[model samples]
Target: MKFPNPHYPNLRYPNRRYWYVPILSALLLLLNGGVNLALMRPLTDVPASMDKLRFHLDDAVFSLFFLLAAAVFAGAFSVLRRERGYLYLSFFSLMASQQFFWEWDGKHLLFGDFPVLPAESLAVKSGMTFAAFLFFRYLQGTNRRLTDRIFIYSAGGVWAMSVISSISPLASPLLPFLSGALLAIVLAYLLLAAGRFAHRFRRYPEDSELRLIVNGFAVFAILILPDVGKDVLQVLTGQRLGYLPVFWEACLEDTFPWALMQLIFVFGLLFFRRYMRVLEQNREAHAEIRTQHESLKQEVAIRQHMDRLLDALSGSYRLKDLEHTLVAEGRRLFEPHSFHWIPYNRKARSIDNSIDNPGLDSGELRELEELLFAADHGLVPGEILPGSKFAPVFIGVMGREELYAAISPKGRPLLERERFALQLLAKYGALFLDYYAMMEKRISELERYHGEQPWVGKLFMQMAEKERKRLASDLHDEVLQELLAARRWLEGSGSADDPMPAPERMRLALDNAEFMIRETCAELMPSFLSEHGVIHAVLKLADKMRVRADFQLEVRTGTLAAKLDDDLSLTVYRIVQELLNNAWKHSGAARVGLDMDQEAGEIVIRYADDGKGMDAEAAGMSPDRFGLRGLNERVRLMGGSASIDTRPDEGFRAECRLPLKRTATAPA
Candidate 1:
């Protein structure tokens, strides 16, 4: 009766123990059976006039026993299974058992001379009608109509009449009529239930449960028709219908069918139990499949968004175009109520206010700056600005040089997938921004170079001529004269010397010429750099500068320095050489520091000197200051950035960030 549900294995009955209900029902049935048996008398003792209607005592006893047993079991099943339909069947059986016990010869078997109370009979009939109504309602499955309301009111009237008749002897005569009315109402309800079930069975012929219920109700309604007819005849004629004798005779016609109906209902309950388990499992399987489907769809959507962001990164050529792409994609991804791309001014050290957006005003901009500053110059997630409706997600692009802020339109937090997409978009957008900045600087430099082509060409030719004359002068004055002197010494050494040995003089002369040639080549380019790498070359340059300027120089390099391209290595060496020369000649620095490292696919170089610095703008414009101009040109040609921070009486500092390119042998 309390079987475990496969879908919900932990399900338990209301009571932990299982034996009390059946035991209690058994005790009650035993007491009722004992009382009925004590009141029963032998068939021979019955009056001769009632012989035609009297049933065998043994047969009567067996029928009563069967009915009572069915009643007890039905009640126990109803309690254990928690089903209302079986409870109603139990009530019907108990009422039928009582009718069989007392209806012998229309009176109690042992008290034939005693007067009968019509109130008691009316009470019993009302209870039977109530039980029938509940059972039919359960079969109907929560659907109620006007007829049900009428049956309810009629049952209420009969109960009220029975109560009145028991309280006052004067109301006894009306009890018979009340009982007739209740019986008619019960009969009509039964017929209606049978008809409804029949219609349902016809429509759903494949449903075995409906077929069983339909047959049970039809048999019950047909068996009760004879009794309803007998009650009508007695009430209309004002005399009992001897044609349909009351007592065990009447029960004999209906008892077996009623018992069969009870069995049908019990079997139906078993079928319903199995059906519910299967239905629950099917529902769970469908729910699990739906969850998996949703997960797969979300994964595909995230991948598509990433692909689109990658395309935008490669396709956009200008900062404005990239900004538009970011705003459009943000709206599609987040469906934000407001989106803005706020640019930051590095020189001003604040957000740019010249460009205006709808949602962010000057006050909001200041608050956003404060928030970024409070977050240690990094972006904060889901931060609410002053007077904003929802917390907006802020993404810092290109190291906070630009910001993308979006607020969800639904005024809720972003999902994890949406947040991840936004982060990726910000990262790719930063790369495009860096690319566009480099392109703009290159284009501007090209335009300036084109404008000054005539002057620059002539200046370069003059410098080349001046450099060639200087090289010739150094060769003539040092290497050329030394070689000629060495040749003369060798020629003269063939003859005898007057005071010193010719071999020692010739070896000395040859060594001096070789030394002069090596010095000339070192001025052209350091041979140590091409042989050893940039790191060692820089160290050698630092050693020479340290002694020449009498200043302490510190140099640091990372592992990435070993992977630099030959061209890039030379560029680095030249930039370091020029910076040191500038510091020694102009800054007169006491101490200098140089740092080389790699970050985010770029080689970073930082140089500083503790010396009296110059006005950077003024020094750049000076015609004689080719060292600073050439340093800027070298960085610019390599698609790198160089920034110098110096003022009069302050230390000079220069930082250069050069993008690393992938080589066949080295990873980028």
Candidate 2:
């Protein structure tokens, strides 16, 4: 069975051209031939005695050259395992044989004067023959199994023959020929093996090439074997072997092997040409396929991203609930753990309060807001995380707006794809946000217009309630006190003895009138609000509440010497007064706390009660209890915001932030 080529279904390497391999091989062969010629020239003039030979540089130079050649071949075999292993192994074997010749030069130098030592002569001959056998096996592509064995066995035989032949002069003369004959047998094995394999597998191209190369090798061996055999037969017959003739024959010995080596070279050249053609075809197909695949992948990715953007935008609307929905959609689509919606205040050139997705730290939220404010109406994809970290994505605004979404754990700066998608998302988001502002502005204008409406009875009717509270304060401060004073005078005037005492009768009439006044005043505005500003009003109201209403009050105000507008001053004073009344009347509590402060250009009123604060949602629905609504409306009229912070049994806290601007002009 044939082994499959390991580099089968060959693909060309884009980085390296195929022609380099064959060109490199050709250069190496030329270098080998040049070195051989340079070395061979000096050997011709060498004396018979090695010691008598003139100093020539060829021996030392050639030894180093072959050592380098061995190293080169070893490296080359490793790189081109499929094509050059056999060739490189042959080159290494050749180097070893040539090196042996120089190392054992005593036989050549002694010649007939000392006589060629049978051992040395046989050893050198065995090396040459083994090297030739390895080369032939390499060319036939059958060196893997028998090459090392051939080298070892051939060397052993030479060693044994040298020992046996040295015992008799006749056998000593025959040693060289015996070594040559043995080497011929190794070559014959290669040639015959190649021929047998090829005959059985002629349809295989490699087999056919092996057959042709082996035939060339066998023919060379056949020519040299007879010449060598004849010389050995003469020694066995006791015939004299002449030195001059044998030395001369060595000069002619290289021709047959050299000619056969040329034939193997031709086969290598053809194989390389066929491989180059196959490699070229593979390269062209690979390039075309890779280009198509890349284009398709890019196209698909771009389309999918566009689709996601369109889907997000199409579902967006201007309602607050819809804004929330949009944020959720963005988080899901982008896979961000947190999302932000910040309104761009164009006039302020700033961003408003940000609504954030859950699980976000305060600093992260602040950072996102800052990035949104910095953007100039295009996808910023601004980086917020450290240069080395990935956690925040600061998506820029759309079209020079203050709106930006800082997506956390989605990482920043956003990738190019993410930037594009965010731009699309922001464009649609800006539209919805702008619409919400427009609707909110119109509603605000309507509310403000209605508050200033002259039709008092059709209005909130909170004025009637206000009038009642003012009356109650007047009764408590003036009429009720006077009536109590009169009663004290009557008691001091001995009212206990007389049923009709004048002072006592007058005090009773005064008390009835005072009682009637108190009842009527409770229907009007609280007098505390009219008597003082918001902070003073809240404090006085807290003082009026009984110990049954648990209460604590804290009030902070600005030192602004300028007086505020009548409408605004009245609004703040009434709202806090009404909230206090509700806390005292409804919340069955032991304590209530009222805190008022000015911060960030707004007055903040906070009212808290420890009493059973009603369910916020349920209380909000009560038409009878419109105090909270009234407070909200009052703050809105003053261009402020109000938030109720409360839960059942936990108590209630109302926080109001009102933008207070001092009136520049009073009516002259």
Candidate 3:
């Protein structure tokens, strides 16, 4: 049975591409086999002469060929993507050293390229040799056997001794002894780091691929050992082993190691292929189950968003006075375990009634409230508790600045959908609360203005209505009559302009006078006010005056919204007009801003000036500035409030909040 190996994440499913590992291992075996064959060629040829020609040819050909093949194998191993950290590194080092041995021997000693190749070349060769040793040293950690460590240290010691022997003339005669000692030490260490470590490391749970690699290296080392030993024996004893030169003898001796290497490589292929086949079958069987799991999660998220949407719609209010109902309904829909509507009293350092979560202890509520207030911009419980087992999923601003907290009932972390639904609920709740609060303020202002100064309020309303009728009549009578007379005179004068009657042409003169009056009428008040209602009138005025202004004015209006009484509409228009007049005369502003938005049967008109404002005394002086005083009174009479915000040198802003229901009347 092929069990799942958590150690190999990518290999959880069978992959046909994995066949490359086996194929490459087989090729490496062929290279080693060829190397052995070449080494033995000289051994069989002659007696007493120790097969010198064959031996030399085999050494030259096999060493170069094996080195190149080893390099290719190492490259292939590096690409395996499985168990690569140490296994690939070991193969790379072994391949690199083989190349070094070939090049250094050929150029400096065998080919006699120079006395000792060059100082730089010699140093480079030494560095490569040391690098190979160091890789095996580090690789010891992946393979647990104590023998791997002994192998690394012993090989390192031999290389150090060889260096000492090479550089000193007094030690030059010890070259053979030094070379034999190093070779012997390496063979012994390889037997241990590879052999002993191979068996011990294989005990790691479920990592068969790693075990196969370890076993393969150990087998190779074991197979090559006798060959190396025979060579060392021949050199130390100054006697040929059999019909072979010392090097050639080593090659013949390697027959068993090379054959065993091939066997181990074949075993590795068979085992991995079998394991991969089983892995593929398991994946195919379970694929549908995994897909269903993912689909269910997605469905749950969709349902959550739908729930939030339904709650929002059900709680929305159509009347301005019912905004508080909208808020309450929204709260009920979200089913927040805890809920609080905190008032932002900027004067007090703390939020009021800020706790919104239900059933929490007082201390917990306070803690959650503090965290909510401390949040930057907005806060989500999950973000605050990050990885904590108990964190809230959603936080919201309830009033103008207070936050609403919701913790999931089951104590599970809040999913993304739940958090989003809560956030939407919170946002809508805040908006409705803001509207309700504004309504209350306007009501208070209306009561004060109507109660304390009833006559003043009434007079302000009469003046606004009179101003609208006066401006309308002026356009309809004086301006229209003059323009009509001018048109008729112009038509009758025609081409001659009564030149025959008089050189001054009395008819044409009358037309010019009428035309000027018509232009003046348009400049004073646009006709849309009486024709299309306040919204359209405001838009038309912005358009007509846009060209004359220094900066652009953006006029935006919401949908048809609730209709307002003529008196209320007149108040809005007059308030906007007064603000624009102030901006033009006192503000020195570059742009005029105006916006009208309606929600819950209420209309809000805002106007801002982007220029310097007057002194504080002038800003607050209602008695001195009758326009401001008059604008305030007109809004109050219509059950609304007018607020002027200005700072000296910055600019001035004015807003009029009006209740739509109180002003609902058929258009005049």
In order, the Cα lDDT scores of the candidates are 0.63, 0.54, 0.54
Q: Please give the ranking of all candidate structures by TM-score, highest first, separated by commas.
A: 3, 1, 2
Minimum summed lDDT over a 10-residue window in model 3 is located at: 117-126
lDDT of 3 by residue, 1-668 (tens): 12223344344322232344445445555555566456555455466344543443534554454455446545544655453333433353344444444443334334445444212223333333344455444434434546555555655565565556555556566656655655576556556555535565545434554455454555554555666677889989999876343443334443442434353344435334544655675698679778778867766755554565446545654433333443454355445333333333333435555434346566755665565445455444223333322243333333354334355344444565555555555554445555555666677876786778776665567656655765676567655665565555556743554444432354555666576466556445545566688887766556646654566576677775566667667767777766665665567787777888886666788888778876677777445566677777667767776777888887888788888767522111
Model 2 Cα RMSD, Å? 21.5
Q: Write candidate 1's Cα lDDT for 1-82 as tens digits.
A: 1111222433322212324334533333344344334334235776754543343343355447647755765766564564
* Candidate with best TM-score: 3
lDDT (Cα, tens digit) per residue for candidate 2, span 102-162: 4544434434344444455455455555555554444444546665566546655764676
Model 1 misses residue 296 by how many Å? 22
Better of 2 and 3 by lDDT: 2
* Runs in model 2 lying further than 4 Å from the true structure: 1-72, 81-96, 99-188, 205-212, 215-219, 222-668
Clashes of 2: 26
> Whose TM-score is higher: candidate 1's or candidate 2's?
1
TM-score for each of the candidates: 0.33, 0.30, 0.36
188, model 3: CA deviation in Å?
Answer: 16
Candidate 3: which stretches are off by over 4 Å? 1-225, 242-315, 318-521, 524-625, 628-668
